[model samples]
Target: MNGIAVAGLSQNNQSESDIQKLLKGEILLETKPYSAWGGAVTARMYLPLERSQVWQQVTDYSRWVQYFPALSRSEVLHRGDGQSKGAKRLYQVASKAFLMFTAQVEIYLKVFESIHQKTGHQIQFSLERGSFTDFSANLNLQDFKTGTLLTYSVQATPTVLVPSLLIQEAMRLDLPSNLQKMRQVLCGYFR
Candidate 1:
């Protein structure tokens, strides 16, 4: 479906039960064709924490490998100069997945983060050098009553000859686990 339709579905499905399910480690993930050759993965959940707390957890690059099982390394290569909202920061990440043996991929990304003082926070990142031919993503956090609603969307095209189906399968299997881990770690801070 289209982006608007997917967003509408997500909003409609955001019930109290859904929020409870997410807090209990359930994650909602969906995929769609963003381009003829590339696809998009959208993961959404209601987090039982303030927006600031959620933002902190996501932007803390040094601790990503600790919470995200697939990530073997997360390092900040360069810090933003703070000239503008679009100030650039560079990061390197190594991720691995095991089907029979381990398959590892390392990526370098340039990220720009922006905060809307009245609304929410956003982080947009694009691949500078990676296994993927093209990769871009955004994390958006919005206030949801007492908690926060987090939505992460990524679009990617593999540089290698990997089937799109395999990519989608990997995303479906991995995104929820990553989100669940993030939720658990962020929740611990409050308790």
Candidate 2:
């Protein structure tokens, strides 16, 4: 795909069938198929905002599609509330590919959990399925000289049999760019 592939963005416990859980900080956790073998992915980010602003931005998550390479286009499939639990507007997420190299590869199910006002960010998102055998991340916010340092950490297990060295190389090449973009977007938002 030339543009981004948007995914559905829904609430954590909107459905009576959906289970409710409380976790610290802003994060996403889930498991699904990665080719033949199933996997998991977690992603999180700390915004330079008070509790309200963080909630606003996260609840209105379709805005994030603008920066993500895989999700260039996004829309709210449904709507929800910030107070009482409800499903967030879902999105259709797709990957952007480049000839031989696929620019993005991921399909997710939105899960917005509880928010800790004292902590500073909202907890949401979990993978319903995709490429990695495992995908999970956490976003932490700390005091920065200029603003807030939005630190992100993802621990994943590749679904394929790629060598660790190759995977390391890919991370080295991609992580910096991804981090820079995140900083730019968040900084711009706050500034």
Best by lDDT: 1
Question: Over 4 Å off in model 2, which ranges?
Answer: 1-55, 73-100, 122-124, 142-146, 158-160
Candidate 1, position 118, lDDT: 70
lDDT of 2 at 3: 16
- The TM-score values for the models, in the order shown, are 0.82, 0.53
lDDT of candidate 2 over 6-124, digit per residue (tens): 12223222222221111112222232333333222222233444445444554555776645555765666546575636645444454634335664454454555454544544344
lDDT of residue 110 for candidate 2: 50
Worst 10 residues of 2 by lDDT: 16-25
Per-model C-alpha RMSD: 4.5, 12.1
Assess candidate 2 and give its lDDT: 0.44
Q: Candidate 1: where are CA atoms >4 Å away?
A: 1-25, 34-38, 82-86, 98-101
